[model samples]
Target: MSAEQAESEPQADLPGPPPGPAPPSSAPPSSAPPSPMQRAVQNYLRHVTVERGLSTNTVAAYRRDLALYTLWLAGEGIDDPSGVTGNHVGAFVQHLGTREVEPLKASSIARVLSSVRGWHRFLLEEGQTETDVAHETKPPKLGSRLPKAISIEQVEALLDATRGDEVQQLRDCALLELLYATGARVSEAVNLNVDDVIDQEVVRLLGKGGKQRIVPVGSFARAALDAYLVRARPQLSLRGTATPALFLGLRGQRVSRQNAWLIIRAAAARAGLDIEVSPHTLRHSFATHLLAGGADVRVVQELLGHSSVATTQIYTLVTADTLRDMYTSAHPRAR
Candidate 1:
């Protein structure tokens, strides 16, 4: 993620930023027929959302990332889906590096590149294009800085900070515990229902790619949910037409993903945590802690509902870090 590597190339067809956010009156030009990449993007977006069953957050990311690719293609005058090449992708990576107007990191570039590759993979499958040029392109070499996971004491402090004798605290406690116990994404957590929590022993999560997995809940998480369901949820629920959602907004409606994130941030802030924490932070910490406690990587992966063990293995990065610390501490020659 070095800035220097990002600043090394200037001669590339750099895509523009997203269509700037504007009021309803300033809608983007739709008068013209869609461009090739635009059409392709629309089709791909539909496939990912409707057929693939990716969550809105994941779909929105594809839109943002793929839009950048489309913009680059438009700028390069490469309208045909059949014309993209490995060189174009490499140039795009360099373009990300050269654009010092705004800071871009190597990790961000890799993510963007990944989206591009995914798009091309789709194209290849559908026969929209014959090339998977993105497949051969190299990602920037990255040393493992490792995923950040706080100590168990920090976790206790984090949850304790959510204390308030009100409906909000109950919701926060449920959300926090569900995240840590089941390792569910914020979207999955918010979309859950009373039925999703099965007798306090396990919860069924609908995860990415429309995959369903049953994950066990710890006693702590179960107790927290029990308290919320008994006290806070009853108070929040209204008479007719109230949602059956396990977690609700102040007015007894199902909470949106954004609101769930807000709840997490508020709790994080209350804990006085200096590092930025998101709902995913809790999930990441959960996976790391579980692995550190000798849970199998595959088991943790299934619990987190990751599509690949490689995604789950990111937690191993934490275990590796702990090993390094042990090495530096215990080995006399190393010191």
Candidate 2:
């Protein structure tokens, strides 16, 4: 697929299934030991999970991508790491692109190739392979796409949609408020504990790679949170076992990421928003609105917990576009 096609395609919540037929079923019982290639993949996964401190979702994506790579290797009658060559690696890339059924987009293919490259590098370092054949291989270059963000008015409408006196309503309001206030990923927001926010001006968030960062809470969000904690949470907590989680489900257990998504969707629908609004939309709006208000890009980077300022710079593009639009409409000499 072309880079433009990759940019246009909507990615799944998790990486999609690998190209070609499904990998060998682990369902059937097998007494035989795993192949050398299989063992190498497992070791690499363990390294990433434990040593690298990758998130569970990230490790799962790596597992899916490598499963396809190993299956393709077996199809070519090569089961050992040392037996694979650069030519084989190149051919596998072709295989991913040429598959007729559910062909992967260029971006998806690129992500899978990244998984393959990481595994090969691991093998070379551990002396399981004589050379890193996949080293020279490269993924397709992806086209840059701007993130979508709603206006401040739209965000207010969405937040207002959740306002009510009921326990669920108060909880939903606080959840949405916290998301916008902190620019947190849904996973990070749902993983928060009561102690992370209680009696504090700032909230603590655990981000990718187990990195922690502190972000200040806006008064609007703080008020909503206070209402939930004071009135709603106590009632909800009575339903189930004690836990440190700040957000609770109907059963009083910690809310899940999926549940958080549903809350955002329902609120968006109630607010009559025409555009799609995921948790990431709030994050995008948070960053974009901050930039538009003259906040330093570096400060926004820190607030969002982005390791690289370059990633945070993308929101500036959105603000730039908005500026161009305003200039064209307002300036009489501008054409």
Candidate 3:
């Protein structure tokens, strides 16, 4: 074979480049034409972003998976949608997980497989391909993970450690209180508008899929929020253009998720807690504590803005584990 042709062949023995940062999206540029495979990938990326309304981070992940898949296809001399087959997709899955260098974890590979399956479906829907080679492909099974939660005592300690008169401290106190009180996701908490807190009795949260729900705020959360709004927010709100966001950073912009995380971590460190605490840790503690206190699962589900009770059911597992631990330690006959 000519050297050029030889270079084009798939190198099963050669490890591909180590996984790198995700490339710029291949969404069809108005200025530059694309190859057939590139056009299909671009269309799918556009579909996920514009039509599906996936978050920027999620869209970036899809872009990364598809870009890697495209590179693998090029090596295999398969440039068009029609050139793909089930065997080819299966091989790609193996390559993603077992590559000598930079092998992906099973969870990561599962995500890549999900992205590939989505892209293939998009190709079939757009009529770019006659067959869906990924129709039968299955994601690798992932181990079940319980939500990480700090004990109620630890949570109380963390909250106490964050108490202060500084504007940022007040904001952090209120933020943490709301997160635990309402089981709000970090994104949901940060995205709150000034008016979302109603009469300081309850707060309206815009959850995933644009769904809104009203959750009653406990007295502590309500008090903290009232203090922040009256004492601290006005000060923090002075630095940037006025926004409707309930929480503001020092720059007066809405607090980013990273900022919320740092606030929680700082509080955890001040409390001298050993566990890694995140905003979601507060949410978990909220649900688990409510469950342990006899709140209904469905009520917790509504409060947490979960679309399905099945998703909310995981907290039951957490409570059960807690019970088992207590039993093991307290009941001598059980031992």
RMSD list, candidates in order: 9.6, 8.6, 11.6
Q: What does candidate 2's lDDT look like per residue over 284-310, in tens digits? A: 999999999999999999999999999
What's the CA error at residue 183 for candidate 1, in Å? 1.9
Worst 10 residues of 1 by lDDT: 1-10
Across 1-335, the per-residue lDDT of candidate 1 in tens digits comes to: 12112223235788875787744666766798887778888999899888888877788998999887778777998987877888888898888878777645888888888888888899899989877889988878776766778878778888887766787788788889888888788888988999999888999888876788998999888988998999898877772256779987766668767777777777777798887778878888898889989999999988888778998898898888888999999999977
The per-model lDDT (C-alpha) reads: 0.81, 0.92, 0.89
Off by over 4 Å in 3: 1-31
Clashing pairs in 1: 6-97
How many clashing pairs does model 3 include? 0
Specify the poorest-scoring 10-residue window by lDDT in model 2.
1-10
- Scored against the true structure, residue 146 in model 3 reaches a CA lDDT of 91
